[model samples]
Target: MHRDQPPLRARSAPELVPSLFLDLDQMLDEFTRLPIRARFRFDPDMPAVITVEFLAERGPSLVWLLGRELLRRGVTAMSGTGDVRMWPTLPGGRPASWLLLESEEVEALFEVPTAELAEWLDATYRVVSAEAEMDGLNWDGFLMELLGGPAAASE
Candidate 1:
């Protein structure tokens, strides 16, 4: 028998400024619309890797909280061969954009206006979300056909 995991609950707000919290909330909302690909590497020398891709049905609240915690500790950007990317939104004139592109071997920072950041995030979210939705539908069809016999195959 298969059992569904319980829903995740967000932690209480950290001691961040109000504006930072607002920005985090806005970004979290956008992130929830798309699927996020994450990879964790525990050993630097080993080829072993763990990867997870989260869809809209599974929220990334923990990711958001971790980003906030990083910001609180004064981390602006981080990237490596790992599959996860974190963009910690900070106050003041700090860079509002951070990207960890593991496949491209890239980790960078961008200082852009808030509106521009939001627009970029929205565009990326739309593209990724659409792709994720299609992938999910395809997987569902495959499973149905596999488990339900020939009658369930798609035309």
Candidate 2:
């Protein structure tokens, strides 16, 4: 999924903000069931075609999976808190491309994209999947770390 260029801002105001709830299982399921070809466009005149098969082939990368999950769930709108900031180092103690999802209530960030996010999704997926397999852990736990959601306390 190679985007022709960087994502261009919409000519008009952003869409209405919807009440958001994080559902990781649902997000993963949706990604798995994605069609062979998906199109995303800020404007109807210009749409980027994403090859779902390519992403699926590589398996899930934590960063790419988070990006895809956020995008699929329509979580892109920046809340006007002005709290979001980019750090050279991520909270997970690694230097990876990512975006900070910040607010007064939460201190977490996810991957950012060098290319169009859609394309980065596929690239990261390929790398992360291989890394996870090599590390001998299931992708789910690795994904949970990258996502930074509520983790159940170990008894």
Candidate 3:
């Protein structure tokens, strides 16, 4: 029997977008992308990333871990440089955002509804403000993990 079902940490309620079809123009040659499941999630543990997971019938689920701040600015205008970037679009009279994930090997583009993404970000802010995100982090522990060694923690 499970003693505790839900974890103690607060998770920002994920925003669900149904039938979030792609808005293609920049990359028409690429194959059509039909997003079966798409949502934005924020975990208190990983407060920096506003993760977006795209689940399709074929192949593994692709995920993009974008900055929470970047997404907030992206809804209204362009934000970010290299690696990741996003901007609002009005392709075929439908409102959407162009989410670009780039790497040296390959690059990908995703079109998400502007309103949906905006609402999700708003909901997350309601649960946890930006200033409060850094309150409980163990910086020394994080650095130790990065350096792969036992490092001293500072208060």
Candidate 4:
């Protein structure tokens, strides 16, 4: 519910992705509660993340950079950067966060982007919303799936 809440744990990467998909619709509703607008633009050619520097070229605004990255990766990612006036030491160091969409529903499609593109988009919204509700919920597991998994942590 709240951003600080503990995350739901899943046994495997596959499980996690689908769960996020299921939560997408709910996530959209939660985002609307925020002061700023969080909209997803679908580009058939791109996945979700665009080049980060490309965003900087346009302007320093948060929205532009985020939107570009989302388009480039085809997955949802978010980060923050306070202007120098706010936190001089942390300029452009605002926390970076990302979420991967691996919906079982979407993956099951016979086509790359099935007619359920809208549903996948909605699932992306949910992944973002849930992450917003929990600050400590790192996207580690999701990232592992993208890049290969790492060795087990030493006890």
Candidate 5:
């Protein structure tokens, strides 16, 4: 077992949430029951970003790279702006979260289960703790390349 190989990294399990296809309408009364798959991932090296891939029955998948902290905070309260936004919602007496992705052409709303979101966040945090995120960044060499400094760049 002493082969001097790279250490095995823990990966956050991708969450497949069943979300209704809904448009950004004020009433929000109607929603197609057709479910879409949302794949979530947290790269340890890119600790600050949270990647989400929304897969639908038709058309191509949409990939979103958002702030991990923003998503975590959104779990409890409304967070984010512009292209992404999230907030807790209780529909049909069930606890869930609403994730809205907006673009100039179109927008989509997803009702994500709060429990599943919590679980996924927990797993991602376990894989790369908040404190370790700074250390995980490869900012040293890259910054040096940008600043033209010698070795040992981090403070």
Candidate 6:
């Protein structure tokens, strides 16, 4: 994480989702702030998506929150990809596995049992951290832009 990274602020779900979808550079900036490692993949036969690996050293609260959000947005559990084993000097490094969340996968996974989702969220939380908060940027305004509306920037 950068020393000057901003803090995480409370934003509505609609406000944040658009940022994840359009602001690639800002999303990358936010991703780098977390201790966990993830990758963006696009296969010709499959929809483009990201694969996140929850690593150790990240705070559990953060991981759980991310897991919950991912689950809410339809992320899926992956198999035969690889195992999540512990690495030295990392947090929640062990006992983790991969989740492959395609556009459809996310839609279906979002319909799963909340209890199961919570469990996964807890597991990921063991090593994740919350993203840095934005100060002047009004995330809601950015979302409006994605909806084909004018973006009303904060003064």
Which number leads on TM-score? Answer: 3
When sorted by TM-score, best at the front, the candidate numbers are: 3, 5, 1, 6, 2, 4
Residue 131 shift from truth in candidate 1, angstroms: 13
For each candidate in turn, the TM-score is 0.25, 0.21, 0.72, 0.20, 0.65, 0.21
lDDT (Cα, tens digit) per residue for candidate 2, span 45-117: 1112212211223565222112333442222343222443332323454322433444566544433322344
What tens digits encode model 1's per-residue C-alpha lDDT throughout 1-155?
12122222233222321112112211233334222333211111111221112223356432311222222222344433244354545666644544433335433232223353344334433433423423323344446556875465534
- Model 4 local distance difference test score: 0.29
The 0-to-1 C-alpha lDDT of every candidate, in the order given, reads 0.32, 0.31, 0.66, 0.29, 0.66, 0.28
lDDT for 109 in candidate 6 is 15
Tens digit per residue, CA lDDT, model 3, 4-55: 2222344454443222233233343467664455656677566667777766
lDDT of 5 by residue, 1-155 (tens): 22233333445433532222222222243655436677676766667787777775689988888888877877789999989899887556556777888889877777776676677777777877877776744454555546754433433
Q: CA shift at 9, candidate 3, in angstroms?
A: 8.7
* CA displacement after TM-score superposition, residue 46 of candidate 2 (Å): 16
The residue ranges of model 1 lying beyond 4 angstroms of the native Cα positions read 1-81, 103-114, 123-136, 140-155
User: Residue-pair clashes per candidate, as listed?
Assistant: 0, 3, 0, 13, 0, 12
